[model samples]
Target chain A: MSLSENLFYFLSFLAIFSALMVVFAKNPIHSVLYLILVFFALTGHYILLNAQFLAIVNIIVYAGAIMVLFLFVIMFLNLKKEGDISAKSVFVKVAGVVSGGLLLLVMIASLKSLEPYQLKADIKTDIGLVENLGKVLYNDFLLPFELASILFLAAMVGAVMLGKRESGERNF
Target chain B: MVEIITKIPLEYYIILASVLFCIGVIGVLIRRNALIIFMCVELMLNAVNMLFIAFSAYRGDASGQVFVFFIMAVAAAEVAVGLAIIVMIYRNTRSVDVGELNKLRY
Candidate 1:
């Protein structure tokens, strides 16, 4: 195996392991930490795939912003109480695992039937760089790009509306 | 650098992404904490993003990458609104457990 393949294997293992930890960790804070690690490994995968712009954006948006939001909510809620009825019944847990495993199997099976195609020589070279990505984003995808801004604005307004304390309530 | 990625078949990426997505699904189904389920949803999104980048690189098209960019944008917005809703629920019930907040059901 070459260096790149070894790196891919290592990164995939880290990502999968941390992703599992994100689900299974007892403390919500630990789950957030694991999710950050998963994002980091994903960033490495993006870099390996030559999507430099995406790698940086993934790190900034996911690890930096989203994970921080999760951590803040977790800490603010003070969810450290013990003996809460957090555990699901065994039947439910087993059903979840079985169904999820079946989904994975079906997806992989479908993928195996696809015809193999040769990698295009000139295609994978540097199209993922910020310069080329920007050109395409501005030209072909300009409309969607502008619409995303509007989505952000609406989300911000909705969040503020939902989170604000009522005028007459002082339950804290 | 292209040789490195090309040496590994695209199917590997497909399988990896599928596994990650399945883990996310399982996490969502079993976890009671709304915050943890939210994190699982993010995991599923990342899995899809990885597949997009991989396919884009394989086909030598920037459109896939652009799609990934939009997915990230939508995910960010979703997180903001969803977290705010979670915070509101917690304030009213003093718990982040989804099972505790089923008052809306008929």
Candidate 2:
């Protein structure tokens, strides 16, 4: 195996392991930390794919911002003891695992039939660079870019409104 | 770089992403904490992103990378609103457990 293939296997292992940890960790904070590790492993995969811009953005947006938000919420809630938080019935747990395993098997079977093809000659190599990506973003995707900003604005307003403590009579 | 990338078959990525997505699904189904479930959803999104970037590089197309950008933006917005809702739930219910918040399940 070449160096690149080795790197890919290592990164995939890290990502899968950390993702499992995120699910099984007793403390919510530990889950958040494991999620961060998964993101870092994903960033490594992005880099291996020659997507430098995406790798950096993944680090900045996911690991830097979103996870910190998660950590803040976990800490603010002060969930010191997470006793018996998962489902109690053994049947439900078994059913969930069975369903998820079935889904994985189906997806793998479908992907196994795909034929690998050689890269096309017209394929551009520098597209993953920041300059080329920026050109396409501003020139071809200008409208969607603006729309995304609007979406962010709406989300910010909605979050603030939902989180504001009520002072008047409660209406449930 | 593209040649080196194509040396590894795309099917490997497909398998990796499928596993990650299933892990996310199992996490959502089995875990009771709303915050942990939300994190699992993010995990699923990352799996999709990895697939997108892999295909984009394989095809030598930049559009898939751009799509990943949009996915990231949407994820950020979703997390903002979702976490705020989770915090509100905690304030009113004194717990982050989803099983206990069934007041609307009449």
Candidate 3:
């Protein structure tokens, strides 16, 4: 009945639709584009929740950086629709859909039945602000934050190692 | 505390994220392209991230949102490595279809 409610529903529909399109798009490039749309919708939801920092981070990290990485790879591969396996079984697809639907039903039925928690009057809304989050990150989560940098270093090394070709190998 | 109120129930976000996650699962199961499957995994991660953010905002707790920050960090690292692995596989097999990569099927 309010603008926020309307925005929520609209973003929800956009996200779900774009997600499905990401799966079913005939071209991998199209799939990547659809995925970007999904990320944008999720960013909109983050803003609606009033997590301004997360909203900006979501858009920058997800839509701007990560999706660009995906698009670069898809284009580098030059993957065509015909490059996909031509004779995929209908049964495998049906089974995947049915199994996923079952999981969705179970999760929603179990989780949605619980009563939603009401926000308290004295709740700390400013916690989502960058200043407060930076304090928490620097103070409480310092160890994990440092460890994540190590993880990034390892990932970078692994990617370089995996991507480089052997000295004697010929291009196929 | 900013006076902005999210009157939409957490249940809606939960359901929306659930549906998004399931779509991702289905995409991974049915898609043969390694890159598409990779994107689906990202989709699932985003879905979970949304739930974390929703909970964090509603409870006025910063921990959950901080956890989401860690998730995005890990996801960034993950994508770098995963795409490289897929490229290696493509170079080796000359194809990116998961069905054709049967070397590990033992």
The top-ranked prediction according to lDDT is 1
For candidate 2, lDDT tens digit of each residue in A1-172? 7888888899999999999999889889999999999999999988888899999999999999999999998888888787836454788778888999999999998866777666676777678999989988999999999999999999999999998988882434
**For residues A97-166, could you state the per-residue lDDT of candidate 3 as single tens digits?**
9999999999989985697677788877777789988998999999999999999999999999999999
Q: Fraction of true inter-chain Cα contacts (below 8 Å) kept per model? A: 0.76, 0.69, 0.71
Evaluated at residue A2, the lDDT of candidate 2 is: 80
List of clashing residue pairs for candidate 2: none
lDDT tens readout by residue for model 1, A45-93: 9998999999999999999999899999888888877345467899999
Each candidate: RMSD to true structure?
Answer: 1.3, 1.9, 1.6
lDDT of 1 at B94: 74
The CAPRI-style docking tier of model 2 reads: medium
| Superposition error at B71 for model 2 (Å) | 0.6
The candidate that wins on DockQ is: 1
lDDT of 3: 0.89
Please give the distance, in angstroms, between residue A30's alpha carbon in candidate 2 and its true position after superposition.
1.0
lDDT of 3 by residue, B1-106 (tens): 1433547777888899999999999999988888889999999999999999988887888999999999999999999999999988888888888888777778
Question: Each model's TM-score?
Answer: 0.97, 0.96, 0.96
TM-score of chain A of each: 0.94, 0.93, 0.94
lDDT per residue for candidate 2 within B20-104, as digits (tens), equals: 9999999999889999999999999999999999889888889999999999999999999999999888887778899998889
